[model samples]
Target: MDHTNKLFVIKLTHTLIWMFFVAVIFYVVYSGITGAINTYTWLGIVLVIGEGIVLLLFRMFCPLTVLARKYSDSQKDNFDIFLPNWLAKNNKLIFTTIFLIGLVLVIIRTLF
Candidate 1:
């Protein structure tokens, strides 16, 4: 591949990594807003905002995206394969954990 293609691959990989993080953030907000807004209460609104902040913090401190970027950069020649697998396997795990946490929060909110 040419130099331009290599740089494109790198940039594309970075964009994908950022996108995963964005999706996670969106999921958190979606879960929070959907759950809490349905109740139509002040506490629920507060919780929604709280969850959004938590999600932002989680994204900020997350190591998985950093690792993914590193993995992507290392495989510019074969990045198409590497980036997807990294995002699919590792990113899925991380997002699943967040979803589970969201589930737990939903349950808690429902119960009390």
Candidate 2:
């Protein structure tokens, strides 16, 4: 496969993975809001936090974003994931805030 094909594959894979991640994060947040705290909830929180560490370690960029840099020269935000440019640029902030809020909700639910 050539670079074009490789880039296409990478983009498709990144989109799929990102979509799945968004879905899982949404589910976790919804569960937290609905008083569904359980192993799955904590598992999702742990996974999100773990990935946040990866982003932090990589300078707030997902590992896939770092990998995508090798394939494309475009400086746009969506160069990595299928999200909008702004969202891609601020992905870390948005996701980390969401995850932290969810964690807090879970803790509150547990305490109350």
Model 1 alpha-carbon miss at residue 29, Å: 1.0
Query: Where does candidate 2 stray beyond 4 Å?
Result: none
Tens digits of per-residue lDDT, candidate 1, 3-72, equal: 5565566556656755655464455546554665244343444554555575477784334344445434
The superposed Cα distance between candidate 1 and the true structure at residue 82, in angstroms, equals: 19
**Per-residue alpha-carbon lDDT of candidate 2 for residues 1-112, written as tens digits (9 for 90 to 100):** 8766777777888889777667668767787799987788878877777877887899977677777788889989898666788887887678768767777888888899
TM-score for all predictions? 0.33, 0.87
Highest lDDT scorer: 2
Candidate 1, superposed: residue stretches over 4 Å from native: 36-112
lDDT comparing candidate 2 with the true structure: 0.78
lDDT of 2 at 47: 76
Number of backbone collisions per candidate, in order?
A: 0, 0
TM-score of candidate 1 versus the correct structure, residues matched by position = 0.33
Best by TM-score: 2
